[model samples]
Target: MGEVLYRQYRPQTFSEVINQDPIKRTLKNAVEAGNIAHAYLFTGPRGVGKTSLARILAKAANCLKLKGGEPCDACDNCVAIREGRFLDLIEIDAASNTGVDNIREIIEHVKFSPSSGKKKIIVIDEVHMLSKGAFNALLKTLEEPPAHAVFILATTELQKVPATIVSRTQRFDFRRLASSDIVPHLTAIAKKLKYRIADEALILVARASEGSLRDALSLLDQLASFTDGRATLEDAEDILGLPPFGMTQDFFDALITGGEAKSFAHVDSLIDRGFDMAQVISSLLQYLQMVASCKIQGAGQMESGLTPEDASRLREHASSATHEQLRRLLGRFIEAAEQMRYSKIPELPMQLAVMDFFAELQPQPSSTPSRAIPKADTRNIATTQNKRGRPAPQGALLDMREEIVGKWNELLEKMREYNHSLISSLRLASVIACDGETVTISFPYKFHKEAVEQRKNKLVVEAVMEEVYGRAFRLLCLVSAGGLDQKREATAEPRVVEVASSLGRADSLLDEAMKVFGKAEKPT
Candidate 1:
């Protein structure tokens, strides 16, 4: 079988490593100055060339054809290392050799001088896999290794490596390659392999790899046998489990504008079609990134995967939402994608993300609503207030409260656009009075009062009132102290008593006092 593309094209020199210039420069300078550390640590995500570079570094230190700390692939040492036949270069898979005994063997080996190469280079892959005892066992030798020994450790999880192990070594962190960097490299390999795949297919492979070039090429290698090597973008998507480009836009459109039902329906459709939920969410995130970029930088500046029409539609959606809102959405999409990695039902994370976004976009009441008012006649409200001797409200305050009440139904309808639960609580209550900047709502029960008075629910209520009143107003929530001095509450009091009683009832009573302003009880 032919060599794998990644192995075939692995960097033999630091200059050949892609998108890790800082690491390359630092390592090359160290070698050139003969300032190489006793132990070196390489940390990064999988398949970004940490292991490949470790091998290169080993060859560079030992290669007789080294120029300015870079290895010449023509040299015997480089060739032997490239062909995996170098005697002095030792490779250990820590994952397989995780015991203290395995580490003790390394300690014993480091005590010897190089047999063939200039340095006895020890390369430990997935070093973080070493047991605590193993790490502890090597700490002394790693800190003070023989002059002829060079220990190089590589790990995907930097945090797992002991600090003592890490502190004793010079560390280089590898980065995940971007699509732009991976695509060209994959294209060159395809040409060498006689594969007739298009750039679009190559791009699909790159995106599918998610920054791992080895994974991308493996897919390309698989594609070589999966089809006739004349793979199209659709073929790549099928192999990669990505839905068509526009499907992501459709998902977002329904997700952002439509409520929970529409969003879930889209999720269900994707599931029915056998699309991977992780890939779907990832594609959605990519689409949103384009939208956000298009909003920040003009559409002309964006290279979206979406077609022109779809891109234009995205632009419209972008223009409609605040950039911060788009940012928040992107953050949620990323978080959901990460959470799905460890989930039992991966679809659940995406579902939770959808529900969260739905809640964020609008008002939805709590399932458990609080009681606000008793189901009874609202008729006695006004009459009972007059008998309580409450004075008639005058001028603008009365006008404002009355206007709020008159449009209460319309406002509640509008409230549905934000949170349905808001309307539910408001339905059980009414605006009894307003003192200019503060409008007090009287609920029939405490549960209804407490439910609506909740900070979030209260904000919705105030926002709705502001939309109706054309200004801001503080919300004051209360449960109606409906019953009054029974006989006195049924009879109109004298004007003198009205003045005194209005003062007392203003703070305590709801409808019975509100009726003193002669605002007849309307519908609840």
Candidate 2:
């Protein structure tokens, strides 16, 4: 069997490693100066060279003919470590051996001298997987190890490792490799193997890897095998299950310029073609992000890894859309991507996201002018009759209604302090009318209306209204099928019974009796 690409091309020396210049420089300097610490911790994302760097450090520390802190691969010590046969260089998978006994075994061996080199290097991968007792067993040794012993730990999760263990070591954090770094590296390897791979295909591989060089190389290996050494852009798109860049661009253009109908039509076409909705959304998000960058930083200034024609198209799209619109679309689609994970119907979340973005762009109705309410008697002004025989809110009453609507957001903020769930229901409601005696709120959803009509919730709203408007007012919640624009019918009244204020007042006694025994006629 042929050797895998990742293992075949694993970095064996400090100079061969990709990215991580600071970590490389510091480790090289330490090895050269003979200033190696008793313990070292390497933490980073997977496939980003944590384990490879640990191996390189092991070889460098034990190299028989070391120069400039880099191991001479020709030396006997370096060759054995590279071949995984060095007696002094021990690599432990802490994930498999996680008990106290495993750590005790290491402590037993730590007292012994190096079998073949100057330093006995112990490399523990995924050290965070160790049990609590195992960590405790290892802590004492990490705090005070022998002169010849050296421990190197690597983990993807730094939080799981105890602080005591962390404090006892010199920590080096490895960063994810950039596309710019991975692309040329992959290109060099392809040239070495004499594989004919397209530049666009290489870029796709780099992007799909998402800053993991090992993953990128493994993907390239698969492409090389699949295409028999000649890989094209189409081959990559098929193997990686990514949509074509052109299709993503066209969909984005339809969404921005062709309106909701055209955008949704594009989505339907994609679905018919057997494309995954989540993958399609991901592709759209990547293209949208490129457009956003071009808009902010100009096409000429971007290193977007796209052909000139593609860059120009992105620039044109950027020019056509506003910054705010781009931001809103990005946010909505990101939410759609998250929602797609748990959704039974995969396309539903994306459809909803599209609808919501367009809905937000629709123009809202203009509100009435804000006029100050007069402090004097509003009874006379409220007595004027409208066409429906209801008292018309003329001067002060109309002003008061407009003022309350304007300050609706402030009332919600105050309500949050009392009941957070009520605030959510209230947000879906609109204040249609606010008279001196009653404030009528219309909700499109029946459940939202029911939530606000509960006696406890009603009293809370009325209390906040009194605090904000300087007087108590009854709440009248109506479930309107046609939203806030629908007028209430006298024949079909709301089902919620009216609630009175609990604040100290003479009428409180009568209101309490009405709740238990129903209303009674007053003695004349």
* Candidate with the greatest lDDT versus the true structure: 2
Rate residue 237 of model 1 by lDDT: 78
Q: Candidate 2 has what TM-score? A: 0.74
**Candidate 2 lDDT by residue in tens digits, 1-524:** 99999999999999999999999999999999999889999999888999998888888898889999999988999999888899998889999999999999989998999988999999999999999999999999998899999999999999999999999999999998877889999999999999999988998899889899999999999999999999998899888888888888888888788888988888888888888888888888878887898889877635456777777788789999899889878977886787687678988777867755664454432111121122332232223334465655556565756677788778878886776556545655555445567775655546567878989989999999888878878787755432232353332222222222221123433333233223443221
How many collisions per candidate?
A: 14, 0
List, residue by residue over 216-250, the lDDT tens digit for candidate 1: 88899887767888888778878888998767878
**How big is the positional error of residue 311 in model 1, measured in Å on the Cα after superposition?**
3.9
Best by TM-score: 2
Per-prediction TM-score, please?
Answer: 0.68, 0.74
Backbone clash tally (model 2): 0
* Positional deviation of residue 354's Cα in model 2 after best superposition, in angstroms: 1.4
- What lDDT does candidate 1 reach at residue 18? 83
